[model samples]
Every structure is written in C-alpha cells, then in structure tokens.
Target: MSNSKKKKMPKGSMETFFKVLRMIGNYRFLLILSIVLAAVTVVLQLYVPILFGNAIDEVVGAHAVDFDRMWYYLSRILVMVIVSSVSTWVMSIINNRMTYRTVQDIRAKAIRHIQELPLSYLDQHSTGDIISRVIADTDILSDGLLLGFTQLFSGIVTIVGTLIFMFSKNVWITLLVIVLTPLSFFVAKFISSHSFQMFRKQSETRGKQTALIEEMIGNQKVVQAFGYEDKASERFAEINEDLKNYSQKAVFYSSLTNPSTRCVNNIIYAGVALVGAFMIPGGFLTVGGLSVLLSYANQYMKPFNDISSVITELQNALACAGRIFELLEEPAEVPEEKKEMGKAAGEVNIEHVSFSYDKSKKLIEDFNFESKPGMRVAIVGPTGCGKTTFINLLMRFYDTDKGDILVDGQPIKNVTRHSLRSNYGMVLQDTWIKSGTVRENICIGKPNATNEEIKEAAKRSHSWEFIRRLPDGLDTVLTEDSLSQGQKQLLCITRVMLCLPPMLILDEATSSIDTRTELQIQEAFDQLMQGRTSFIVAHRLSTIRNADWILVMKDGQIIEQGTHDDLMKEDGFYNHLYNSQFVNVAQ
Candidate 1:
C-alpha cells in the first residue's frame, strides 16, 4: 500500500505510435485538409528553388544580366512565399485544435476509468502517482502529437517531390543523394530505441518523486512531530538524485538524434555538390542546373533531419502515453446489471463469513451473526482484532471470500453499491472533510436538507456553537485547517445526524472530541438511536456499557458475547478488558 505497483509496461514504439495516429480518426476531414494544405505548401516551396535556379540561368556574369526575366521569376517567387506562409499559419491553427482536443479526450477517459477502478487497486497505489498519470503525462503527450501532426505528412511529400524534381535535372546527382538516405535512418533508429527506454524510466521516476513530495507535504505536521524531518529529507534527496540521472540520460540519448543524423545528411549534400561540379566541365550540366540539384538535395534531406528531432519528442510522448494507457487498461470493478434497491429495514445477516487480505493468512473465519431491526450491537476488540475489517465487510467496501452479506433479505452484491451504501449513515474513526461551504458539507449526506434541519442536527451534535461563531455561519467556505480535529469530527457526526438513516455504522466516531463533548454527544445519540439499528466499534469500554449486546473480539473471533451485566457475571475476557480499561484511566 506504499509504493505503486503496476503491470510491466510494453515497449511502446509503433504500437503507441499508431495509437496516437488513431486519436485523430474522428476528425478525418480536418486531417485531410491539413495534409492537402501541407502538400500545397511543399509543392509551392519546391517550385521556388527551381524558379531561383532558372532565374540564375537568366543571368550571366559578362552581359548575362537579364533584369526583365530575373525580375519576373523574383515576382513569382515572392507570391509563392506569401501563399506558403499563410497556408502554414492556418494549418497550424487546425493542428493546435486537433492536438488539444485529442489530449482532452484522453485525460477525461483516464479520470472516468479511475472512478471505475476497484478500491483494492487504489489502496495499493499512491495518490500522487495517479495524479501524475492523469495530468502530467497527458500534457507531454500533447506536445509530441503537435510536432508529429505538423511535420509528418509535409516531410514525406517534400522527400518524394525533391527526388522526382532532382532526377529530372540530373540522374547522376539524384542517385548519389538516394544512396546516402539509408545511413541517416539507421542512425536515427539506433538512438531513438535506446532513448525510448530512458524516457520511460524518467517518467516512472517522476511519478515516484511526485508521490514522495505530496506524501511529505500532506503529512508535514506528523513528520515534524515524530522528529523525522532529516530522514524524510534524505529519502527525498535519493529520489531526486534518481530523477536527475534518468532525465540526464534521456536527454543525452534523445539529443544524439540531431547531430548524428545531421552528420549523415550533410555528407549526402556534399556528395551531390561534388558530383554536379565534376559534371559541369563535361558540358553535361549548366550552372543553374547544378544550383537546382543542390537545393533539391538540401530539401530532400531536411525531412529526415526534422523527423529525427521529432523522434525525440515522439519517444517522450509515447513514454508518457504508455503510463496513461496502463491506468486505462486496468480491469475495472466487476460490472453488474444492478437494481438500485434503496433504504434497508435495518435487518442484516452475515452467514459463514470468512475473509483475508492474503489467502495464506486468514483474518476472520467461519463467522456468523445476525442483527434484528433496531438492534444496537457493539463490537469491542484489541488493536489487531478484526473490528475495522468487520465494518469494511458490512459496508461492502470489500466482499467476503466465503460467505454472503444480506440486507432486507437481498444480497448486497445484487444491489447497486450506491443504493446499498445509501441505506446506512456511517462515520469512521478517520474523519474526512471535502471542500465546500459549511452547509454543503453537512448536507452532503442529504443534499436537499433544509436550513432548520441542518441547524437542528448541528445543535444536537454540539457543533452549532462553532458554526455560529464563524464569519458567515453556514455559508462560510471550509478549508483544510478551517476546523479543528474535534470540530471536523463534530461535523461528520452532524452529517449522520442530518441523514438519520434506518441503519448506522459509527466506528470510533467521537474519539477526537473532548470527554465533556463525548458525554454530551452520547446523550444526543441516545435520543437519535431510539428505533434505528446501529453498529458501534469503540475502544473505550465505558461508552458501550448500555449496548443491547457486546461482542468481545480477539484475533478475529468473538471470545465473549453478552450484555454488560451478563459479561461481568461470567467474569471472562470481557471482564478482564473492562477492569484493565478503568485501571489505565485511573493511572
């Protein structure tokens, strides 16, 4: 439940590469338009180089200045340049929209998938790791798609167009450039494959760093109180060092793309120049024709160069997307064609129940119990006993391995979880407060609760005094430190008081409050529990003395069960616990 555990990630190259391509499938028309615009830009730009070469042919050094003809080509060149620029600008706009929309779709899907994941999965992973997948990874993926979408099609068209035009000018020089193309690709392939692994490690390391930062920050008070600041800093430094190494290695390998491929590309350019120069004196090629070959050579190799850089971005993008895909691909909660069976009549039966977190170590075995309508059943136990586990089972947070939990004669598994959970008003030893107005937090259990009803519940739970003293009373927005632990617990109690369901589960619900308020709350709960069936898990022995039945648990089994008087008369495990609790309190 500490470090995040996940399935082994696939080496995402062509698989994730194509997955990104498929994201734009819904916008085929825009994609086609972008390609068309790209082709138009490439064609126009390719023609300009030829025009410039012809314009050069119109000029000769000694009375070779043909101003009229040169001006004509220059004017045509100007028009083409403007058109290409405008086309690229508009195409960029289309690319941005498609890229951001695709990223948004992925992020939304990841978040929705999170809601469907089982509690067991979330319990095993950290909050920061999940946040990194949902937010940070998607952002990096967007940058990669933008580069790919803008360059890929244009680069391909430029490569083919340059070769055809170059061949028309001179076959010998064209073949030389063609012969050298594979070398550039081989270099790119070698570097990109290795860089992909580094980037993947970098993403994983970032997740760890993010997880650690959030954990330490969220529990800084505890860390300081426990005098663990130095150790915490040391742990953070180790993760940060790993992050630095991975990032540097990823950047170093990815950076190799440009210089390595450019080295190959530059050789191809020089080869074309050398071959064309030798052809000039043989009357096999003119000066203008040689310039055309040079231009085409650069144009043809430019795509490979651009793509090499894009490969680095693509590697990083794929790495992040791979992490996001892992989360999306996780198996969701078992889907059932559920019926929302609303409130229960407070009749619960647990039959032949056996459970464990691990199969080798059984926690609860062969347990059987029944609570009739309006029964106040108290579960008391030592720290390692199955008290909290019992509450989780009853709430269907985790299902039993060997038996059934029934409410109102219907199995909980058969009903929709929302409806089943709605049947009980539950408060735990751990209090939770979400961001919202004070009124909203109280009414979370009963959203449409009236003002008078909220005030009444708050007053009964002894939380109304703090509520009244606040700046805006019920309308005041609640922040993390806005309420004390006791105040937060009081609000949690108030929520249950407002709901007042037919069944209740209170697990150490008043542990944080002072003794005076606990007594006041007990009096209020006495009135509230008049006809409702309740399950109370408490460590303080005196508080549950009035319970209809008390079960003393040890390991996972009930060692003693009876009313307070009955258990004392038996003088067994329950009596020992009761006597020890009073002795410790006296000390």
Candidate 2:
C-alpha cells in the first residue's frame, strides 16, 4: 500500500469506535431513560446497607426496635427494586431493538455501496473477506453495543452511588476504600490494552478462515476432481489452529481481570478490618458504621470487575467495526453521473485506447476500433491477449488509461454507466444462474417480460425443448444438476434475447458446450445478431467465419484484420490460429 493509501485507512480505531457510538446515539432517548432508571436503582440499593446498619444500631443501642419504621424503609426499597427491574427490562428491549436495527441499516448500506463499486473492486478483494465484513462484523456490533452500554451505565451508577454513601457515613474508611480504586483500575486497563490487540488478531484470523471456507465451497468440484481433500483439510486446520491460539490468549487475558480485582478487594478488606478495629477504641466509628463501610468496599470492586470483563467483548466488537468501516470507506466503482445515454445508435468507436492492469506493463498501445450500426465484429485472439479487457473498456467496467470510447459520437465517460449498460447485452463463457425457476432466470434480463416474449426467446435459443421436458416446464427450478453447461448457455442467450438490446457482446458464449449444442446456440445467436451491432470474442475459428469484420488481436494490439476468408488468404496470425484448430480437429 502507498503511504497515502495507508493514511486513508483509519490509522487508529478511535474513528471506528466513535462511529459505533453515533449509531447507538440514534436511540438517545432509550439510553437516557436507562441511565436515569439505573441511577435510581443504584441509589435505592445503597439504602440496603444503610438500613442494615440502622437496624443493627437499634438492636445494640438498648432502644426498642423500630419495627414499623423498619417495615416502611424495607417496603420502599422493595418497591424501588421492582420498578427498577421493570425499567431495566424495558431499557434492554429498546437497546436490543435499536442495536439490531442499526446493524441491519449498516449491512444494507454496505451491500448497496458494494453493488455501486466497479467490477475491478470485487476482483481485488476476496469474496470471503467481503462476506465476513457484511455478516460477522455487523454481528459483533450487536453484542458490543448491548453489553457495553448495559455494563457502562450500571457500573458508573453503582460506583458513584456507593462512594457518596460511604463518604457520608464515615470519612477515614472512605479514604481507605478510595485508595484501592487506582490499583483495580490499573489492573483492568493493563488487561484491556493487551486483550484488545489479541481480540483484533482473532477477528482477522476468523475472517481469513471464513474466506478459506468460501473458496472451498465455491470450487468444490475442482477440489474433488483434483483429489485435494487432504490439502484443503490441512489448510482449514492451520487457520483453525491459529484462531484457537488467538482466542485462548484473548480469553486468558480477559479472565485475569475478575480474579485480580477480587485479590485487590481482599487486601482492602483486610486493611479496613485492621484500621476499623483500632478506630473503634477511639470512639470514631460504630459497629454498624464498620459494617456499612465493608459493604461499600465490596460494592466498589464490582464495577471495576464488570468493566474488566466487558472490555474484552468491546475489543472484539471494535475489531469487527474496524473491518466493516474499511469496506464502507472504499471508493465506489461507478459514481452516479445521472447523465442519460439518450437512445444509443449501436455505433461504438474506440479511439487510440491504451490500457494496462499494472503501471509497469502496457497491454494495449494506441489501439483503435470502430463498429458501424448492425455490424457483426468478431474479436479472435489467443488467451490473455486482452480480448475481454477490450470489451470491459467498451462497457466502461474499467476506464482506459489513454483515449476515449465514444457511443453515437458522445463520450461514454460523460454518460451515466447505468444508462450506457442498459443499451447492451452480454453473455460470458461462465453462465450465472441464481437459485430460481428457469423462467425466473431467463426473465432476469427483462423482469416485466411477457410469457409470450420469454417463450419466444427460449424457442430462439433452443432452450424451450429441454425446458418443456422438465416436470414444471417454465417453472422448473434451476439448479446445477438440473441443467447441462450447454443448457445454461442457452438460457443465458435467451435472457439476452428477452432484453432485445441495441448491441451484444458474447465472450466465448458457446465455448463449454458440445458441437451439437454449439451449433444450435450459434444459430440462435446469429438470429439475435441480425439488425444489432454485435461483438463476438471467441477462440473457436469456426464460430466467427461469417463475421463482417475479424480482428486478430495479439498482446492487446490488432495483428491482422479482415473477414475469416481474407485473413486465411493473408496467412498471418489469423491464418496460424485457424490452421491450428483444423489440425486439432483432424487428429
């Protein structure tokens, strides 16, 4: 990463942390109400120790026990407890609903932003990592916001209220208790800082594990065919082990806080006992006062311990939030320009276009091409010769480093990408079929397509016969096992046919299908190509024999140009490619 890019990535987690706080702030009313209720609860709780002390004083001071007053105070405390409990429950419900809603909004926004990003962005990031951020990271925020807020409010209230009541009853004991506060805090902070780093490591490792699983599932066929089960298992085991190690470290550090705080509490208790015993003879403190002071001392350590335990959880949440924010911060691929293409005329002109994936290597140098309306232009090339890159530039999937792509004399850059793409149809070697019916897959191109229109397109693509044989016909659910590669290609072609786009780009559309299926799809493709400007990218010389123009590309430059017959007569790169295919067929 460049220094500028590194700087752009959030340097510290402070910004991401504050982002979560702001999201939680959306439910400010609930949080404020929770705080008020929690404060009242803590204030009422303090009276428990005071009430015990007063009851003890009554019994010891040779006075008749004030049972009526005792019952009144106890009844008030019980009522406060019930109200506080109800309020806390209400606060919890509101907090959880708000957290879930906020996370949902964040996920939805991330998904929408991801869709707007260019294909190049997806090509760069691992699918697993993106999925992890969207799913797992958002989940982290839920628990973090829930526990963090609950503990934070409750802890602060308890600590403050306990300290105030302790000081009011006795000064020396309060000072002794306050003296141990820093020690507990220091211990919690030490554990928190270390555990935070470990939790971040663990979260990142988990994302990698998720990515590995996704990769395996996506390429399950390849793995099984190659007999890579052992290799895949080993890879997963390594990631799993790393996750286990990091998790153990994080948990170990987090687990230390409670016990450490308790040790400090025990030391404070001993100091209070020894100090109070000496002060009792001096008439400075009563037995009941000592008992109240002891209770406050124990209550004071609880918050510190609570903060310590929840800190680990907060660290994990912060790590997840950081990953999610990083994805959300990525620059969008296609900025919404809002300028319409204004009825494209199917005329595409590429002028002196130069391009490269990496800065050190130039793929296309001064490349130029033009297709008049209704021309069947075939781009034939050896693999890795920038055939797909040419189509990508025409579609504005990636911008050319030097030169312009003009559609009907208008610069494509000036028009909105969505409007520009709406005018063209594309089919790739790999067909994508989502989990839906065959009809749904075909109508994906034009969702509002009529039944007649869909069937007509299917018939033209030669898919209607297979679709009819299925149990549900058009409604037959499409799955990997339900359709052959050729069938899927035909479905994709039918989808494009439904769109009736002004132009079409076919990238090895029939490459995976058998000769019989290819011929059937090719016939349909030829019909679809009529009266539409088409760009055919294919390795098979036989498919593009009748093209109006054949451009032989090598290393992103046109090495030869003409119809197939003309190229054969010229006996150049095109001739070489055509001859090689014939030799393979003969053998």
Candidate 3:
C-alpha cells in the first residue's frame, strides 16, 4: 500500500450516519418537539438578562422602587428560569433516546456490512483494529451527536435571541461585538484545521498500537520461546510515544482557542466601556442600555468560545467517522444476486484454472482436474506446492485469475457462496477448538443434530472413547483444564463428521495425532469415506498408500499422477517421496 493510500480515508461520502438519520424521518415529531423545547428554553433565558438590566436601570434612575413592580419582575424572571430548566431536561431526554436508537441502527448495519466483506480484507487488516473501528469509532459519533447537536441547537438559538435584544438596546455596541466575532471565528478555524490533521494521526497511531498488542497476545507462545519481551516492549513504547505526541499537538491547538477568544473578548469589552462612557454624556445611551449591551457581550463571547472548543471535538468525530466509512465502503466478496445451489452431488471440475496471491507471482497455471462422484483422490506434494491453494480456490475463498471451476456441471461463479460451501466438509491442517462443550462444537456443523447423531459422528471420527472418558461425556467442556492437541483434532474431526457433507477435504487431518491415534482414526476414516468423494492433501506418503489415485505436484503442475503401486513402479517424484518417508521411518 502507498503512503497516500494509507493516509486517505473516505470523506463526506454519503455515509451510514446520514442513512440512519434518513431512517429516523418518521421520528420528525420528536426532533421538532426537542427543537421547540430548546427554542423555548433559549427565549426564556434571554429574558433573565433583560430583566436584570431593567431592574438595574430603575434603581439607578431614582424611580420609586415599588414593591409590587419589584415582586412582579422577580416572579417573571423566576418563572422563565423554571420553564427553561424543565424544557431543557425534556429535550435532553428525547435527544438521548434518539441517539441510542440511531447508534443501535448504525452498529447493526456496520456489522452486516462487515460480514459481506472478503476474506482478504480480514487477512490484510488486524482483528483488533477492525473491532476498534466498529466499536470505538462508532461510539464517538454516537456520543457526539447526542451532546453536541443539543448544545449546538440551543446555543445558536440563545445567541441569536441575545443579539436581537442587544441591538434593540444599543446597536453600535452590538456592531462592535459583531466585528470581534469574526476574528474569534477566523482564529478558531485556523486552530481547527491543524487540529483535524493531528486528530487523524492520533487515531491512526492508536489503531496501529491496537494491532500490535493483538498480534503479541495472539502469538504469546512464539514471543516467550524467542525471548522477545524487550523487543515487543520497545515497539509498543515507540507507538505509544507517537500517539502521545500527536494527541498533545491536537489538544494544544484546541486549548489555544479559549485563551485567544478570551483576550479578544476583553478588548471588545474595553471598547464597549469607552464608547458607552462617551455616549452617556450625550444622552445617546441609557444606563439600562449599557447594562444590556454588557450582558449581551458576555453571552455572545461565552458561546463563541464554546463553539470554538466544540470545533475540535467535531473534527475528532469526523476523523473517527472517516475510519468507519472506510470499512463500510469496502467491496463485498460475493455479489448478492447469484443463484443458490440447493444441494450438490460429489462431482467437481477445475478447468484451465490459474491464480496468484500477487499478480506478479503465479501460484497456479492452467490447472485442470475432474473428480468422479465417489472417488478417493489424494494430492501429494512438497511444501508450497499449491495443494492448499487448490482447495481454497475450489471453496471460492478466492476467485481464479483464469478459467472456471464447476460443481455438478454448474459454474461455481453462478452459485451462492453460502450454498456452495454448505456442500463440503473440510478438516484443515491447523485445527482450532473454540471454548465450548464437546457437544456444542460438534453441533456447530449441524445445528439440529440430535445427541445420538452427535455420538455416532464422534464414534466415526474415533473421538467418542476419549469423550466418554471425560466426566461429562458429550457435555464435557474443552478448555485449558481439559483438552490436548490430539483431543482437539479428534473433536474437529467429529465436528466435520456431523456435517456429513457429500464431499470431504482432509488436509493433513491426522498429522498432529500419535501413531496409535492415527491408526484408530484411519480405521474410522476408512468407513466414513465409503460412499463419499474424498480429497486428501497430505505430506505423509504413508497416508495415501491405499488411495485410489494420487497426484504428485511440483511448482504449479502435476509432475506424476497414478495409483500408488503404479507410481512406485515408475520410480518418479511420487516414488522418490515414498522412499524418502520409508528411509525416515527406518532411521
């Protein structure tokens, strides 16, 4: 990937956030209600300062302070305060509910989109970073939308109402305050632009740190074996330092806005005082008018400073939004309109297939193969001879660069991926046992399988004996306290057996088991393969000795292919591999 590519993220593209908002179109009533409540609150708040100015002017003008009038003004101010407080509380409640629903919708859509992404996407990106983008980045928008939008709506309303009252009292002072407003805005914009880049850098660095930690923890055994604790710690520290530096730069720029705005506000206040002093002598400004102007100045400047602070937070949310959109925009692995294959017979065909991980280095070239409905086909190869790649291609985990693969004479490209995969059972070289009961693991392959069915499958895989020996039998939990590697492999085999797929692919399924276990499992496998089309990719020549057909592979081509006896008589690659294995056994 290029540096430019790494730095670039989807921006202002019609994102899921907007889609979520559109979906809430039916909730317009709640939204409008909140806005009305906020507006009412702001209008009421504006009256408090006006009332304060009126009361001040009345006393200063030597008007007899009537108790009834004084009580009336005080009561009116108190009523407005109560109304504003109640309305604000209501609006906040509604806003929070809307935000919760919106975030839930976003999470659901994002998760579904992630499921549609290609296997290659998962391979290229770290699990932790992807999770962080989905969980953490989405949360930024969720929390920001809740608080930021509410404050923004109310602030704008309050500022506008406050300005109107200030202009009514004394237009000149309001004009002066407006001039200072632009300066504050310009300074804020400058800070925001730099802060945005720093925030983006910070998020990216954090993602890298998350990926590194996940890699270290996932490979703890390798790290311990190699004594790489110091090296890993150094790498983590370097990423941490980069995160700290970027975060500081972002916060430093954000912090400058408040002090800068305050200095400008103070200067404006001084100008207002000087102008008011001159005007008061000429009867152009009243004492009450000056009071109102001062109140408005404070009101306007406070929110302006607040808005400046919020600009940085908005930028941070946008940076997070950009990362999330990147994942949502990734191309899906399989298109949705392909035909679903209900069931498949055992026939498989690979015709003129060619492929490569990187286009520059081809791994399979013009490969062709055909398997009958119930034949046992064993693939023999040295390491890196494209055996696994063939299986992956047949499984459609990847698309071939050239030609086509077909099952039961139907082109694989036209079939739904889910349906195509449902027809095969695969036991890979690296078996994984999830933390669960033995029965749960087996039933995963066939969710509706009965206990009797599960037990029968386990017997077929030679896994039932060990399962029965456990304290809980089929219900026994496979955990660090219970299972071994051989036991895990047996359970994996039992899981595949439960699926009972028409076609089976065993890629070194017995490689991790002991000789005695292998012999036992081999007997079970012999019974299981009776009527199924079986594809075996194995390194052990002994495993394929009884196979109906064996193909010796090299590079991207089959070097020799025949029955084991025929290959042995020919004395070629297959013969050489067989002899080498025998020599090892003798040694």
Candidate 4:
C-alpha cells in the first residue's frame, strides 16, 4: 500500500455515535421498553444464584434438613426463572424491531440526500461505493446495534445487580472484584485501538473491490472486444486479495480481545474463591455467604467478558458510521432560483463564458456566441475540444464559472432548472433505455402523451416499422436482447420527437445507425428541427453540410464560423476535415 493512502485514519467520533442515537427519535418508546425489559430480566436472573446458595445451606449443609425452607426458596427461584425467560424473549423482539426501523429511516434519508447531491459529486465518486454505504454498511450497523442493545444492556444490569448482592454479603471480596474489573476494560481498549484502523481499512478496501467489480462487469463487452479478459480478471484478483488480507488482520486483532479478557476474568474468579475460602474459616463470613459471594464474583465479571467480545463489532459499526456520516454531510447542489420562465423563443446567447473542470487549466475562456431562433447551428471539433462542454453549459448540466447564458434574453440561471431543461430536448450518442415496454420508453419525453401521439412520433422517427414487427409490438418488454444498437438510437429519437421541445440538441445522435437508417433519421431530424433552434454536434461532415451556420472549434475557441459551403470554399481546417473523411471512405 502507498504511504499517502495509509495516512492516519479518523477516529470514530462520539458525534457519529450520538448522531445515530438521535436517528432513533421515532422509535424511542420501543427502545426504552426494550431496555427496561432487559434490566428487569437481568435482575430476576441474579436471584437464581442467591436463592440456590441458601437452598444449598438449608438442604446440604444443615444437620437436619429444613425441607420447608428449601422448598420455599426453590419455588421463588422457579418463578423468577419463568419471568426472566418471558422478559428476555419480549426484549429481543422489541430491540430488533427498534434496530431495523431506525436503520430503515437512515437508509431512506441517505438515499434522498444522494438524489439531491450535485452531479459533480456523483461524477467524482464510484456508484458501487455509494451503494455499499446504503446496503452493506447499514446491514453491519444493524447487526452491531442489535447485539449492543440485547447483550450490552443486559450485561451491565447483571453486573451492577450482582455487585450490590455481593457487597451486602461480603465487602472484602466485592472490593477485590471491583479493583480487578478495570483489567478487562484495559484489554478491550488496547485491542480495539489497534483493530479499529484495520476495520476501517477493510471497509475501504471492500468498497474499492465492489467498484472494480461494477466497472469490469459494466464494461465486460469492451474488455472482451479487446481480448483483455485476463487483464481484467488479474486486476479484480489484486483487489480481492487486498480485501482478504485486511479482513484477516481486522479479525485477528479483534479475536485477541475476547480471549485475553477471558484469561484475566478466570484469574479474578480464582482469586475471589481463595479469598472467600480464607474468610469463611476466619469466622468473618458464613458458608452460605461465601458460596453466594463466589457466584456473585462470576456474575460481575461476566458482563466484562461479553462486552470485551462485542467491542470488535462495535468498533466496526463505528467505522461504517463515519463513512455514512461523511456522505450525508457532503454539500448538496445549490438551490435553483424560483423564477418561472415563459414559453422559450429558441434564441440562445452565450456571453463571455468561461469554465474549467479544474481551476488550474481553463478549457472554455471568455467565449461569446448568439443564435437566432430557428437556426440550425452545427458545432464540429475533434474529441476533447469542448463540444460537449458547450452542450453542458447550454443545458446547465454545468454552470459557467465567469459569464451567463440567456435563452430568449432571459438569463438561464434566473429560471428554475426544471423549467430551463424542459424547453430543450436532448439525444446523445449513448442511448439510455430502461427495462420497460416500448411505449413506456417513448412516452418518457411526454408522460401524458396519448397512444395516437406516441405512434405518430414513432412513425415520424422511422421506428414504428420496427416496433410493429416485434412479438408484442409496442407492448413488448424492452431488454438488451430485445433491440439492436441502431434500433435503440431510433427509439431515443422517437422519444425526443414526442416531446417536440422549443430547442434540440443532437450530440452524435445518429452515430450508432447504419448509412441507410442515418439518411432516413436525418430527414426525420430535418422535420423535427423545422421551427426549433437546433445545435448539432457531429464528427460526420455530411450531417452538417446544409447547416445554416457551422462553428469550427479547436482548443475551446471558435476558429471559424460560416455556412458549410463558405467554410469549404476557404479550404482551411473545416475544409480539410470534411475532405479527409470522404478520402478515407473512398479508399
């Protein structure tokens, strides 16, 4: 591992612990009930050893057996045992209910918060990492919390109740137990301190492993196409091995805590026995009292043993909590302005706009442009030359760092994001088709669109012919196997045609279709762009040959702007680019 990656781990903060406590606000009554039941159960259980010791004295130690007294104590013990069993069962029910409910609330809140977070933040983090927090981490927390509530609460009650009984019977032995009690805590603290970082590392490694798996699986086609399946497998193996190592180290350190504490506890038990033996013969304590003291000693240290073992789970829960809180606390997207916009006239103006992914390197700088309504403006450039950035700014997927964009002379930022985006329809190269019927996918552009309107749009986009040939026509369930790449792009175009927005953005929209289909889709696109202002981002010079204006972009600046024929006559960059593709095709 690299040193930078091995930087100091953040301690599990009390703030995170208490914040989780606060999340149980709605389930407070159930939580309190569970605790009360646990405490009562423990108290009732403590009476077992006391009553049994008295019975031992009355039955086994006495010269003449006191049958009545023995029966009386045994009856009370029997009654207490029944009550404790019932209480323990009820407590488990209530505690689990409380834990899962609180966890459900946390998951809901986290998911909602994720939705509101900025696109920039989502782009920077892995989807698998985010999913792990929602699913895996929350499950870990639920387990730890359930264990803490059931075991920790009852354990403390048992320890405190036992100590009081022991002290009343024999102060010397009780004091010794109390003095030696800190040893268990010391062992727990030492082992937990060492293991916490390992648990944190384990969690981080698991997230990375999940991310790699998602990436590889999502791009399995690409990996196989390039014959890189072995390479991908090798990479996954490396991450999986790291997760195993981290998990092993974390488990090893946590395992040390329980056994070490048990060893100390055994010594304490033996010491108490020896002390009680001496005190009994010294005439300081009765035989029955000595027997009760030994039982109390074991009960008192039992809580320490149980808690020591649970410290590992508790620490792991805390580590998971820190990650969850970190995500919850991330800054969300800036609130959109509330101003409503009127019907857009399809005129857009970019005035002195500047932007950069990073501040150190500006990609788009002080750029200016204007498009009158109903103009087909084509933007042509090589990859990474800011064609998409222009579209991003226009759609406000990203805001310009320096200047403003205006639609129909109204500043884009001044209007609500929903209203702004509603005026434009987009069809990108990468088609997004959900697992739904064909009609459902096309109606996404206009949720309330009628069946007649949907079919009309599909017909106009040249997709209805293919849709009718399917087994169930428009009602067929869509999946990856249900359609080809070209067919998917045609469906996307059908969706946009259904909406018929005031402006259109075609970002390599026809790149996936064949030459014949591309020609048909282009004619359909011409009809769609008749009255709406359109921005066409294309590498195929043929797609923009008839554009009213063509902007030749290079390194974020507009190197040339003219009609396609005008640019071709100049025989500059645009001319060479347009001719080069034709030459390659001719050969």
Candidate 4 achieves a global lDDT of: 0.87
Worst 10 residues of 4 by lDDT: 1-10
Give the per-residue Cα lDDT of candidate 3 at 298: 78
Model 4 compared with the native: what TM-score?
0.92
lDDT of 4 by residue, 442-493 (tens): 9986989998999999999999999999999989999877899989999999
- Ordered list by lDDT, greatest first: 1, 4, 2, 3
lDDT of 2 by residue, 297-404 (tens): 777777776767677678788878888887888888656656898667799899999998775777999998888989999998898899999999988899888999
Cα displacement (angstroms), candidate 2, residue 168, comes to 3.4
- Candidate lDDT scores, in order, read 0.89, 0.84, 0.81, 0.87
What C-alpha lDDT, on a 0 to 100 scale, does residue 61 get in candidate 4? 46
Instruction: Give the CA lDDT, 0 to 100, for residue 44 in model 4.
Output: 83
Listed in order, each prediction's TM-score against the native is 0.93, 0.92, 0.91, 0.92
Clashing pairs in 1: 60-64
Distance (Å) between predicted and true CA of 31, model 1?
A: 3.3
How many residue pairs clash per model? 1, 2, 0, 0
Model 3 accuracy (lDDT, Cα): 0.81
TM-score of 2: 0.92
| Model 3 alpha-carbon miss at residue 542, Å | 1.5
Could you tell me which 10 consecutive residues in candidate 3 have the lowest summed lDDT?
A: 1-10
